[model samples]
Target: MPTPTKTGKRTSGLPAKTRLQWSGLSLAIALFLFPIILPISGLDGPQSRMLGIFLAAICLWVTEAIPLTATAVGVIFLEVVLISDAAIVPVGADATSAKVYFASLANPVLILFLGGFMIADGAAKYGLDKNLAALLLRPFGGSARLTLLGLMSITALLSAFMSNTATTAAMFAVVSPILKALPTRRARAGVALAIPVAANLGGIATPVGSPPNAIAIGALAEKQIYLTFAGWIALSLPIVLVLLLFSWGVLSTVALPVGTQLELEMKVDFDRSRAAIWFYLITALTIALWLTESLHGVASTIVGFFPVVAFLATQVMDGEDLKKISWPVLWLVAGGIALGVGVGATELDKWLLGSINWQSFSVLWLLLLLALVAVGMSNVISNSASANLLVPLTLGLGASISVDQGTVAVVIAIACSLAMCLPISTPPNAIAYATGTITNRAMLLMGLVVGILGIILLAFVMPFYWYGVGLLPVN
Candidate 1:
């Protein structure tokens, strides 16, 4: 480490981290200019340039060359500067190109996440998360397998409605006391691994569960295909449940002697304040509204504001509390939305889908293709970014394939969540890794086994599940 001089300023040339950032940034810029400098076949004009921008954005996002939100901001800048024809001359408010690029800022999908963050923040504020976890889990007692599964199940339940990272962080806090009370490393690893693993699995169960699921829903709705909140959960819950059980088994092997009885006092005493009670009521109300959206003809976006307003009113969260919400995440989601919009506006989505030759492909082949593309990319890139990059492409195929967009969307989003092999794959994985408890080799072995099972299972079950749900045709 460089030390400060007497003048209180360190004299350093450049750090390795800074150099890496510069290198990644330089490579991203080069990739951005690649299409413009040397035009490709079939990508001759604006599409080529825009494709360059997309690829560069994807590169920077995956590499962490700069802040992901800043990369998104850069994308907006490029879109307006290079492609915003409406900005050159006003088109009399008929939805300008510049406006299209930035439309995601006001996207309802993002609003849903905003409300979720507020609820999560409020839950943390009043210790409701710990109390809820303790009450639900205390029944398991000392039965090790049940305890392990119970921990994962509760973690998953919370993740089904909130951010997985937040859920995992909160769950880990609840479990740290348990981990210390456990005698063996094996016992600790079992519960420790379960937290993040469960978070990833639960995240795919609903639109509000994860950014990728939300991305799938938003992209599908753009094509006139929509799913009620319950509709999405019904389609995905089976997958989450099965994967959770399978992961528990895999983790049990690594966590040998998992049968070892645990004796931690799972009871947590947190008296419910009025703020906490209001938080629960508002959160429940918001979820109910989302589930019954089709019945009442209420869009989830309109219902999303319920918690945001109610939380502040009850003093569960004040105005300053809004700043605690993850603004970068909002920016990141907005960027994905903007990218999806650009892909459609430039007809690039159509062109890519048109090239797929859907008639020549069977459903199995298409499913495999999507799984490979999504899972392979997600292992290296963040799952949200993976979904953002691919969901738009998949959405474009609904017309060409004559298939139900809802079915395809569910399968693809789940596939993205199967990327659990690396620490950098997701926020939950990173959190688990930072604990210094589980080794990378352990994560790699266990995660790959679970990930492969998830992919194979998703491929087989999705067609039958959707057909039964009446979303896909029974061919």
Candidate 2:
């Protein structure tokens, strides 16, 4: 037993995790005060204040000293109090209205995400996701190698329309029995690794696929650059497909190996009840509206609310079902939007742009550097937070570089999703790691290969491909 401390608490009373969280919170405060105590040479008062908030947000987000959503909402509150019109110590010229910061909580991008979350939640409630996986997996046959491909393909496809984390959970729930049935542990690890790798890569396929994607879209919208939902799919889907196939090949070869034979028993039991059927129709119509935005001239954000209204009004998804939606994810994205808004409103972006001589690096090198930095930061922090910090700054580079804001924002977003080396890198990665089938070494090796390949694709190949195909504006 541990000795009691002065405060009558045991010396070992707090868990290591709790102690670390408190330490992180302390560090965040110190970092936040740094800019205030020692102002930068060129930034104005408002800029310095924004810089402090930005640093503090990075520390809190990276450490998870508080709940991720708490840190997000905290950032918004600080921005309003410290730099908005409501600030106690007034700063001239750049201060924005408090409403602007608060409004981020319901930004159109978030509304779009909310709609996606509703559909995903409804799918899970009605057993639609699992049933779809079962129906889709039938064509790939029983061999472990082919099954790996089938599983990855389906995971990626589902992740495109759903949260990658949710997709991984749903997929894993479907396959956990098969994993236990596998004779060799190595085959289990291989099969297990495929789900997260596919889900992470697949998240880049559409704007609503992951939080980072929504972060990118939200940031770009503030700059008057809008990417239609289908447009994002067109830009990223090809790369997502190629990376999934590549990862599938690596996992099948390195983890599963040759001569590994396994059989799977997938049960398909989709709900055919009245409410489930109504949900299905609403979901299909919403997705169709999202995809045909160009033809219909309906904004994806407006179309996103269709399901929200339809599900609630018809009782297809009642209040209980609504309660199941991932509210934190939406808030996290909103915090990112508010961060971008504050940075832009304060002209901190201009100051930061001037602080760096971005022209010193060639276009190719700069793009590579941005993607590499995004991957590195996201490996240890929430990818959404990484995008939150990086996107606004990258968008500022539009004035300094010849590349369009869309390309830069999307590159960073996709690069963030490429981080999956550690269990902490993503919820999907954590879920896959929790199954105890794969070792840390196995995950790191696969994540590194896939991450490097993805970086190379984003930095070198995709830009030119986008330009050639007219997806990117030619410089």
- The best candidate by lDDT is 2
Local accuracy of candidate 1 as per-residue lDDT tens digits, 1-475 = 6778898998674445566677788888999889888967676456776787788887788788888888877777776666666544232243336876777776888888888788777777777777888888888768677778789899999888878888899888878887887777766776788899999998988778888887887777666677777778878888889889888887766574745776557768775777677777788888889889879988887788778887877787897889889888877777777777777767667777776579898777677778878888999887878887788767677667756666677777888988888888889999998887777887787788887777777666667877887755535
* RMSD, one per candidate, in order: 3.4, 3.7
Give the per-residue lDDT digits (tens) of candidate 2, residues 221-300.
Answer: 99888889999999998889899889888888876767666677778888999999999999999999999999999999
lDDT of each: 0.78, 0.89
* Residue 164 of model 2, lDDT score: 90
Q: Candidate 1: minimum summed lDDT over ten consecutive residues — where? A: 87-96
In Å, residue 152's CA in model 1 sits off its true spot by 1.0
lDDT of 2 at 67: 82
Task: Provide the global lDDT of candidate 2 against the true structure.
Answer: 0.89
Clashes per model (N, Cα, C within 3 A): 0, 0
Where model 1 places Cα greater than 4 Å from the true spot, the runs are: 1-7, 10-20, 87-96, 253-259, 353-358, 472-475
